[model samples]
Target: MKEKTSSNAPTDTELKKWQGSSVREKLVQLQSIFETTKDAKLHTIAIGSSHVSFFYLSSMAAEEKIYDEFIPKLINAGEKSIKSMLEAVDSANTGELQKVLSEIVSGKTAVFLNNEKQVYLITFRNKAKRSIEEPNSEHIIRGSHDGFIEDLESNMSILRYRIQNPDLTFEVMELGKKNKAKTAIAYLKTSYDPELLKEVKRRISYIDTEIMLTPGYLEEYIEDDPWSFFPQMLNSERPDRVISNLVDGRIALIMDGSPTVLIVPTTFFAFYQSTDDYNSRWISSTFIRLLRLASFIIAINLPAFYISIIGFHLEVIPQELIVQMKNSVEGIPYPPIFEAMLMELTIELIREAGVRLPSPISQTIGIVGGLVIGDAVVQAGLISNLMIVVVAVTAVSSYVVPSNEMSTTVRLLRFPLMIMASIFGFLGMTFGVIFILVKLCKLESFGRPYFAPAAPFNLQGLTDTFIRLPIWLKKEKSNKTGSGIFNKKKSSARGWEKNEN
Candidate 1:
């Protein structure tokens, strides 16, 4: 009996060598490699008196397309060779066992002719996927309603539809060892910084892992500071958003099986800007933009600020209000810190429970938990009325942030500030803020400063950072060139004077 090869044995070089010309021998080798899985199918067909063996995974291969369309075409085409008969788009002839195995696993059927050295691999992937719909997470009041689906090709097509420019380039690469998930890097060839592109490619190539489940897994490997609370790369399901970032000279990474695509070298300001800002009038957009910025501050600082004031700085309150506040918390059993933590934890649990349950049931839970349970807690004197208002406002403010990752970061950051405020009162919260600022200043996103137009202080870039400047007035500035690339002479954006009577 032939000695069986170990499954863990290296097959890179061995697979490159042709596995004997015998069809039955090849079948035995493939069955062994695939562990005789039921999904691995071998279909035998006689094409013009030549017996050909077609191998593919039933779960991945398009069964109807293969049996009806491809097989009939092959049988009718009385070509001299198997390669000539399988002359479809993306069709290739290969002798290497490695190539044949890879093609079959990737939803391509491999046609093996008896006594023939080469195998014809044809692409026939047709998997069921979710239909294109507006993303629930990044919904906009006015804009393109379509969002990216799980299929990488569909996502790329959506991006192509938005920007038909030829300069927009996409380079594909494979990640993960066992699964080998496909990943694509997209960027405008004309605008993208060469160094930035090289850096992104280098980082992705260096990701050594066994399995990459989603873009989030790859993100953890590529981000500059993995420990930082702020996400260096922005994740979005909207194709328009991806196109906009690509136009801005940034690179986008789209992973197979993940609906959300990632944008790199992003600034803190990018997270705050919404697609609605571009759709609406400049004045209204600017107002909402400023409101979002205010909400960020309120979300992170409100709880701690309340804890400091009520616990330490009672003198700040007016006499009548002070009396009212004292009366409100008079019967509360626990300290301010304990009371705040308990309410925060309860809200977090309810929020999580709502998220985990079905949509209709979750909505019911939110109403009952937010109103009924909150009122019960107040009446029981477990938490003060002011504390309830503070927690609710903070939660609402957090939702105002456009990026979900940033919103989550804001929620997580409050815990440390709350702890500090409990121990050191206002001083503790002040120190926590200072530490965060220092960290933000030190952080880098793909080697670009995270806090741009604010820390490094770019006047031209600042025009659109906090406020939504009119698109016509906004000048195209190269992120790499800084002020050197700006046009010296300013033209009337609207050309209103030329039309004047």
Candidate 2:
């Protein structure tokens, strides 16, 4: 018998010709096209005696024999699982390629051959994943006990599980010209503002970058203006957080391989929210939300405020407290800003070093670093006791931001305000504050107002904006209707007093 080879295999001349072409072209030119999927760990290709099994790195399970045995059993169960492919078989594709890949990677198995135009889908998906855990950054006592995981399907499932209405739509687009990163846009088709959805989709679709390694990549690409320091998109890992936005006429984008989900068409207020708000007592939720907002203001302005109070406006503080603050500053030679900046920088260094170091050393670094540095700096007469207090409060306040991105933005923005206050005192600090507010006003996330329901003043949204009002108050959905709260009141509430005597 003569040996046989695939006729499509490229020769030397053809291979060289494709060398100048793009990666996709080069891939198609080869005998086995699956080998060129970039993620070498994935892109599995096994040529068996009976059939060619082409699938992803993680999808194929058992062995070549398992399919042979299982296919026959599926037919006997009255399932037309694989009529032509097998006597009995189980199959599921749902007609979407993205969905197919997601299902397969999450545990389902798909089989394709070299000569086949269509693929055989099977439902033998078995995933081993970590048990659901709290989101470290967005942890709250009262929120849903769910969080996003690295799996894209798992993240989408989180959203779907919460908002199980047909009007909720999950639209996906491939980003990164080469990487082909999967990005899913989710919004309530009926509840979402058409203009808002269209604009978000437009910006996302226009992301022409080469690589979208994370949600941050797509975040930056779709930002209204790149230079703005304020985050145009709010990213969250909490499923409840994303669901809340979806119900409020917002869109969310989830990227594969990232635990974080991006909530688009966001306002500044969204970053201040947590899942706990909706879950807690109304009063407590309102109070905590207010505290978080106040903390943000205090965090960003505390150091600058200290400088202005001590260096420029001494009359503002009580005389007794002034005496104490002055006593605390007695030996310090540096100005309030310098002292403040030094301590802040030290704290940041300790924080960053702690993160980069091993767990054992990082804890020691945080404790020892704080004690040694604070004592040494005080002894060295470089900063005042009051400045230390200011920096400490600021650092703690920065942590109050639910989103890490917003926290970082707060920290970074604080520095410039500190510098400005240091140089020109209260006038400089005032200017910096005004600049930030103006910059925020100019910022937009996917064309919707970023300062919204606040800047645009959607009074109807106030019930759930800064405070999570009782469910009854929030029962009336946003004006954009389609996928929001309906009936304006709960059956439980309405039934309570309606049958009085």
Candidate 3:
């Protein structure tokens, strides 16, 4: 980059200082920059009477593109004809030495032209990338199966396809130091707050980190609360999910080489909701949401409740079930907390193992390993069958949350609650729940309510927080200003009913 350029200037648009005003001098400076790399190819090729020099990285397989698509199409008569041919193809002339070097490093071909007033950058970047396919973790039976690939341009195209509005904006920023990465942010200009977008950009700008390999890296750096267990930002692989929130006036952070995108200013309820919820009937969707909420409760509190009952409040167990439970735990040498922790950690270990192993073996390990471990634990009286049932159900319930980050938070929140329950019975669980609620209410994601609706109690937000409204009852929300609050787009979606009446 140019020494005169502000150090904080985003690398994507920043210009680099040129060595001289000639094409040959620019090529010499380019070679000097990559003097140590053997993969860098700088050559002088003749076209008619004129010889122009070009520079590219050989490792990117750009030579084939230059010969196949570039040379034959553009180089017949000389510099003048070359200029005309460049107008027909995707190419740009940049005087910034660093900009051209960045393009070359990223696999694009840079040719010097206009006597080095500007370097011609042509698109010869790697063409092969992961095909758009369904995301494994966020798959839905009734929603769009297409997910984002590692390429940022392709992801932006997917978003554009779904949101064809003119206000939709996609801007790229260079993140990391020494090894800068292209990080992009997408949002609808009219829908989101300009100040909010500015703050996001500002935070990204001031970051002093050297690498941002994934959206997670960006999320961690920019999130408001680093110490909080709750994720202030939501990460998702589904394009439909991202666009839905994008239309809702949220910002999406995308990184090159990472499929995951981070959506900011998300509420707690967003994690509990899914794309399929809209695809199904409203009644079914509401029911499923309720089920998920119930699962959330059960997942975090089930084992803890068991500990309270067995260790502190035995009388709360029903007389009919008391004998079965007592008999089951009678032979166990450890306390309820011990058994609960053992089983929970074991389940987490199995999950991690399954994830790390190959697909075929992971499935086998999750199923066969879980079954064998549970059966053996119960048979040996190390863990009760009742406890096994509770742990298994809890594991399933934690995974019910659509967002994996939130799901993990739920899994982790269980331990502290379990410890509290074991010590003070229902009272400890009460404190735990109260503390979590207080934290949620107090936390803010990008200066927006993280808990949302419930904390501020916006009636409109609440309408779709716990239970979604029927499609017929739902009205479109449009933000004319930058408030990012719900404003009725129209009087009604079913206004025909009033006319008929």
Per-model CA lDDT versus the true structure: 0.84, 0.70, 0.81
Q: Which residue segments of model 3 deviate by more than 4 Å?
A: 1-18, 478-491, 498-501
Summing lDDT over every window of 10 consecutive residues in candidate 3, give the lowest-scoring window.
Answer: 478-487
Better of 2 and 3 by lDDT: 3
Locate the minimum summed-lDDT window of 10 residues in model 2: 40-49
Best by TM-score: 1
lDDT of each residue in 167-285, candidate 2, tens digit only:
88888777775556877888887667888777777777677776689987777777888887778787888888787778777788898778898876777888888777778788998
Query: For residues 12-104, what per-residue lDDT tens digits would candidate 1 score against the true structure?
Result: 644643454377777766766766466988889886678878888999988888899877877777647456656655789887786677678
Candidate 2: residue 68 lDDT (0-100) = 58
lDDT of 3 at 382: 99
In model 3, pairs of residues that clash are: none
Ranking by lDDT: 1, 3, 2
List residue ranges in candidate 2 displaced over 4 A.
Answer: 1-83, 86-128, 358-360, 479-492
TM-score of each: 0.94, 0.79, 0.91
